[model samples]
Target: MGVHGHAVGVDFGTSTSLVAARAGRLPVEVVPLGRTTRSFPSIAGFRGEQLLVGEDTDDLSGDAVIRSAKRAITQNLETLSVAGRRIPADEVITALLAEIGRRAEAVDQPLSMARDLRLGCPAMWDGAQRQRLLGLAEKAGFPIDETTLVDEPIAAGIAWVMNRSLFYGERLEGRLLVFDMGGGTLDIAVLDVLSDGPGTEPEISVLSALGAELAGDKLDQAIAGDLTSDLAAQGHSSSSARRPELFTALVLRAARDAKIALSQRAEHRIMLPSRQLGQLPMLTYTREKLEEAFRPQMDIAEALVWAALRASRLTVRDNRSAADLRVLTPEALRGDVDYVLLAGGMSRIPYVERRLGALFPGAQVFDNAGVQPDEAIVAGLADTISYRRLNLHRPGFDFIIEWEEGGQLRQEILYPAHTPFYSPQQVLSGQSDLGFARHDRDFPGPRSGSGRLRVRSTSGEYLGLAVDNQTMDGLVVRFGNRMDFKLYCDGRILIRDGSGRALHMRVDRWPVIRGRDSGRLQLRSAVDREPIVPTGWYMDKEYAPPIR
Candidate 1:
């Protein structure tokens, strides 16, 4: 697919946010949202009645800035009044995204001209959470859709292939593990390179996917905890019991800066400007000390990586997909896996890279020059749009699609559990016959509608964006098999089964939502009893609706 025009991609991260775009024939370009930075801090606060985001936010004794809102949103922090109105990560994230959109529009070349927008998200977000993210993007001003909500690791994987596949395409005969460690989450995906044809490219089959709440922010907290204890040991007059908020706010920023510095330098000194201790001396932190503090977090990260691989039923040798299997070590393979692509801000840390390399020593690791950890997801998303359209989404479940083939009724699949969907242009040669469904342009009616608002409930039958009142794309929703409800995606309305080889097409269902933490859009079934509900908002579901 020859990318002909402009398309925007946004990576709304835990610590920061990025907006990128790909113009015709150009590389993915990061849209600078700050005066001197391409990455924008994902924090928002209120100054009186006005909302402020990014560079303008200040720590007004912890009341002014909302930090780690993404985690709160994902975990469904019920005491959202925990962070005030932006509580649970809703309003603050939307505000942050709106700010990003403003920045993109200000660029001289006019990125505003881009018609479609793609947003990257954690792979672990389930149906409700994904629905919530789409809702937030609408509140933030980006017109997104169900299909546009792509997995972050998959986007990073595409970006990896874009850079390395030109020469290494054929050599990537085996699978490549995508290990993404960002500010707030760790995501891993095992992709099997489709090499069944003579001229196959980097099209991949996502074997298994998994994510963890652990990430760089946790490392920063670990470091801060260590520093706080050491400072208290030095007989500094500290009472977190008295002012816990202030203490953490002060320590977290200082600790994060120290970590970033320690990445490029051997040592860093942190100043604890405190009144309790009456101006303490500077604390010197070496990379070794930082790594030591990160030990526990790294251990969890390593475990999650191997766990994800194990989920794929992949090991050093072939075996029955039936019998149990074990994860292989670098020594076990000796040399089989081709590459291990690392993305996210934490990957810049030498200790992280070292640990990852030790786990997969047989493969080459690329960090994309360390210039754009926050930008990779969005950049790759843009590349997917402008370069070749491919959706690396893993199907949620196996659907029994009933279609007619040789004048006889048959049952097959719209998509398999581990297979990926690709545009006709992006499909590799032999892989082309796989017959994966696409959601591009098959609808004949209105493309979208005023979104069906999901208020307090177990959850919707199927969580997908609505295209008009009649048609919708069916999201393979996760729910108990016995329950019943409607499923929708873009333009396709779904019942319990379908023809195996279906093509997806619907451009009008671009997702747009009027989200608000307080808006009550209650939906119930024609049947009795509600089955699904939000455990919590994922990606900060609803803090405030757009000012539409």
Candidate 2:
């Protein structure tokens, strides 16, 4: 399917935000949200009920200004105090999004005409987080639903493929790794790309996606902390010691600007004015100093890359060892990756490019000439909408619920892979209930005691579940009586007993199970199924009886 009309993509970063649009068959263009730049700060402030966002917040100061509102969302903060008024974080984010929409409209690129809209998010975000952002987007007047959400790293891969096809007249087909280092998080994804002939859009399937809260923001804080120490050494700690919050914000912003400058130069100057200490002497921040502050985070990023590779089963380590160790030796893995795509503002660091190149020796590292690190995600998102790309796919592995019965371990296939989980009808009704089953028929008779109930993948890797806001690999519940298990289309698992005691958790991560025919799983449409029966017993209708 081709784009029916205009399509818009929004990449709401922690420190900044960007919007891109594609009209009919035209190329994707980044919509300028600022006066002179294509992107603007992801910030909001209030001056006595007068709201300000993006570039408007540039001259604002004090607690009224909220910086990194996206980070606040990640930390699950419900409300933020702005100008003596407590405002919901979602509303703050909605204002920023709405501002972007207004700016796009002012430039004759209104989102109202967009037939498709895609919002990019962190790959590791839970269902609740995605839903939160979707709701915010909807409130901001961009037509959106669950389907509108796209993982940021996966979007980067889509951008690479689209760039290769549209400009270079080449189709990208092979294992692609996306290293997206943004302001607040570093997201790594391994994808399998395949093109079907000349004019057709490429099919991209995500093999594994992982993320860590290690990126530009942390790097900025590290640099700022080092600068603070230097200032204290020079007898200039009055203002910072008094108005620490305000002082910290100023330094972090300076550090962030210096970090960007150091990307293209050998050194950057950091200067700050203080009413308490008067004007302080300017300090030179060298590239070496920036790299020194970035080393620890870079180490974490390398480990995260290896972790994503292991999750995708692209490495040579045994499955058991790969699953057990958090980090693996890079020497143990072969250079099977075809291309390494870099995205996000932090990816502009020369050290980052060199490090990734050394890590993936045989793979082609995309340089800035071929890709714009900061614009890739938004561009890719717009391309996904323009080309009607089919990248979102069903789970490649089955979900297993395990528990002990009669002194023996028993397991049931809670949700099977490649099955119809969602449909347009379900979306219209705003219901995602996939299946439900009674515990008596789905599990073996339990002994008269509390037993451990675990949820795992088909490969026996325990999946994390958040029960009542607490994440756990397994849950302990009394299992002598009748219980109910309900599975939702959004990876939510709900378990309830006859006594009305209920426990629920959303499965955020699934173990990758490679197919026998190929190492990659084919992309499947998310809305290809019919409206599933809400009360249907999935275990009885699909799989055999529980295994002991």
Task: Give lDDT tens digits, candidate 2, residues 192-295.
Answer: 77877555677776666767788888998899988888888888663646666666667777888889999999998888856633577788899999999999
Candidate 1 lDDT by residue in tens digits, 1-548:
34466777888889888887777646677878777787888877667777677778754445456766677656755324332453445766667767777887888423334566777878777655766777877776666543466688878877766655442333345777888999888888776664443324445656556787888888988888878877777765347335655566677778999999999999999886556324676888889999999898888777666556544542222432211323255255434456788888888899888998888877887777223655678777776431232423333333333333456654333333323322112211212122234332321112222112122112222333333333333333221212112222212222211211112222221122223321321222222332233232331345431110
RMSD of each: 13.9, 12.1
Q: Please, what's the RMSD in Å of model 1?
A: 13.9
| Candidate closest to the true structure, highest TM-score | 2
List residue ranges in candidate 2 displaced over 4 A: 1-5, 62-64, 81-87, 238-242, 274-277, 314-328, 368-371, 384-548
Q: By lDDT, who's the top model here?
A: 2
TM-score of 1: 0.68
The parts of candidate 1 lying over 4 Å away from their true place are 1-3, 78-88, 108-113, 166-172, 194-201, 240-244, 274-277, 314-323, 327-336, 369-371, 384-393, 396-548
- What TM-score does candidate 2 reach? 0.72
For model 2, the local distance difference test gives 0.68
